[model samples]
Target: MDVDARLRELGLELPEPMTPAGNYLPAKAAGDLLYLSGMGPIRPDGTLVAGKVGDGGLDLDTAREAARLTGLQMLAAMRAELGDLDRVRSVVKLFGMVNCRPGFTRTPAVIDGCSDLLVAVLGDRGRGARSAVGMAELPFDIAVEIEAVVQVAP
Candidate 1:
């Protein structure tokens, strides 16, 4: 099944590509791989998610949800670029960053937000190696940010 069909089955819909707020490209094609830049938890309405892990009144659960939303936004950007999600062969790498208090201890859980979504959306093929780390803050005060390395059909 293709991505459109899967979206139908999953009762999900892709959002419009999130407009880059700066000069950088949203995604870059490197041979058969697409490297997406770290992006915020952007909503379909074109606004970034607003919260900070263990800060700004956001707890771990809220932080994780933001990460999940970031993952979905990443997929939406990829789908727009490739025209189809099935073109994805393997998800090679994922990097997540969480904006949190100075000594928060939920990096792994925050990263799980993205990992779980990939498995749900692309099954085993979408699962990948990942790294999640905490930072003093993130761009736009986003609770989480995520980027992906996707192997695409030639």
Candidate 2:
């Protein structure tokens, strides 16, 4: 599929890939797989979607949107590393972490925000093995953070 065209059809634009804050690279490649560093819900303007989710905090819908935004950040990193989205053959896995109040058990539902967007943009190739878990805190206190692995065309 034409990934760029698909993004246009969905009216989505990838933000600039976030720069690494420390010494780690944003993405690294090994063989045919690309590994993306953890990405957060950073907007195009460089602000982050920061907050906790669940009771007395951000609601599920807001957290879900943050997850989607985090997905876009990952895509931005992938494009920066691969030079094109089409280089992606398939999404391999995703490790998603949601910053939530204690007792929140909807981590998977929140992460479905990113998973759903990926399937929409890349069809079946976007579906991947995934794990979603809650965290008491994350870097920048962002609402969501995700890391991905994808198979790519060399």
Candidate 3:
């Protein structure tokens, strides 16, 4: 199955790439590898949903949803660069940061929001190792942040 159909199977819709907030580039490619910048859950409407998981404002489920949104944004950035998700060879690595209370123990679980979404969208090619961390804070105070390193076709 193709990328779009796969997304439909998972009931996901990828939005257009959101404009970069500042000077940073959306994504960069080196050799066969593409390094996607950390993407936050800034909806196209420009409103920001900012909070931390396990924190007072953002709870675990909301944080997980934010991570999933980040994954969607990551695909948007990739499509902006590579034209099609078919260029992706493999999702090599994913780095996730979740804002949480001091003793939050579900960091990895939260990041599964991204991981599971990627696989749902990209199929087996999206499966990859990942690291999820609890961060003190993040830009825009978003609930979660995610970056990815992926191999693309020649």
Clash pairs of candidate 3? none
- Candidate 1, residues 65-107, lDDT tens digits: the string is 7777787888888987888789999899999888888778889
Q: What lDDT score is found at residue 2 in candidate 2?
A: 94
In model 2, the runs with Cα more than 4 Å from the true position are none
| Backbone clashes counted, model 3 | 0
What are the lDDT figures for the candidates, one per model?
0.82, 0.93, 0.86
**What is the TM-score of each predicted model, taking all chains together?**
0.92, 0.97, 0.93
User: In what order do the candidates fall by lDDT, top score first?
Assistant: 2, 3, 1
lDDT of 2 by residue, 1-154 (tens): 9999999999999988888978999999999999999989976677899999999999999999999998898888999999999989999999999999999999999999999999998899999999999999999899999999999998
The candidate scoring highest on lDDT is 2
List the candidate 1 regions with Cα displacement exceeding 4 Å.
none
Of 1 and 2, the candidate ahead on TM-score is 2
Which scores greater on lDDT, model 1 or model 2? 2
Cα RMSD of all models vs. native, in order, equals 1.5, 0.8, 1.5
* Top TM-score hit: 2
The stretch of ten residues in a row with the least summed lDDT in candidate 2 is: 39-48
Q: TM-score of predicted model 2?
A: 0.97
Error of 2 at 76 (Å): 0.8
